[model samples]
Target: MHIEDHPVLGKQLQAPVKFYFNGQEYKAYKQQTVAAALIANGIKKFGLSRKLVQSRGLFCSRGRCCSCYMTVNGEDHVRTCMTRIDEGMIVSPNLEDPVIRSDRDGD
Candidate 1:
């Protein structure tokens, strides 16, 4: 879902970088976001919801929405849309919602 040739920007010049999605090797541009890269690879479903288990993907390409949350590089609850792709990076679905901690709970 990307413009191959922009009327103004023209052709893309970014080199491809290797990355892993749930243990499966995939390719993406160096400057592309994890979500955009995944979408470019024809991956529509990012993960399932915690309560309903409904499929979720890039609803708001912007980082304001949480629909694109996933695990990246051994970290939980990463917003894939806002994360840039890096070589050898690992991305995975957060199947279950992570526990949220509040400062008052520890006090």
Candidate 2:
């Protein structure tokens, strides 16, 4: 989660700003992710289990795991690990559609 002198993203990240999450406003930076920004601000509960609906959050900072899945800008089941946060972006928790997931399972 260290954005300073990043190998690819570089050091262009700037000061933080207020952004909307669901309905609440949160302060985030242009370099941080919706999950990373949220976690750094003392938020651990990002979403719930798909079947049991148990509270879950960022397990691994890397994108290998899907623990950080959430909705961004009205889309559903977006992996927060790979998605960058944008100003005024809306973040929320939602389930992935079983049928669509099944169809895209191997691809």
Candidate 3:
């Protein structure tokens, strides 16, 4: 099955919104959350394990959960699931470091 037109989100979406991940450009809809936008761009894992350094990504849809949390605009620990995106926003990894593993690649 496929979505011909979304009933809740509407068929005609707003202008394509642009944001950056690891300094790379990408587009998303104006109505989408940061997490949604990232997911649309094929981002599977958005975070790393606190200790083990395993990959992490969104599990819960609501902001009450910290699963989608990441750094936005250089601020630490912002919830991507709660933040609605705007044009030309910049998103980057927020790893706790003194050391970055080879997995420091973008989502």
- TM-score each candidate: 0.84, 0.71, 0.78
How well is each residue in 1-107 modelled by candidate 3, as lDDT tens digits?
A: 12226888657565688899889998888878888889888886777768888787888878776877677876667789899877988887656642333455442
**Model 3 Cα RMSD, 1 decimal:** 7.1
Tens-place lDDT digits, model 2, residues 2-107: 3556688687657766667668888778767778877766777877787887888888878888888888886777788778778888887655443454434674
Q: List the residue pairs that clash in candidate 1.
A: none
Which lDDT value does model 2 have at 32?
A: 76
Candidate 2 deviant stretches above 4 angstroms: 1-13, 95-107
Candidate achieving the largest TM-score: 1
- CA lDDT of each candidate? 0.86, 0.75, 0.76
Better of 1 and 3 by lDDT: 1
Q: Please tell me which predicted candidate would have the highest lDDT against the true structure.
A: 1
**For model 3, what is the alpha-carbon lDDT of residue 16?**
81
Alpha-carbon shift of residue 15 in model 3 (angstroms) = 2.2
Write down the TM-score for model 2. Answer: 0.71
> Scored by Cα lDDT, where does model 1 land?
0.86
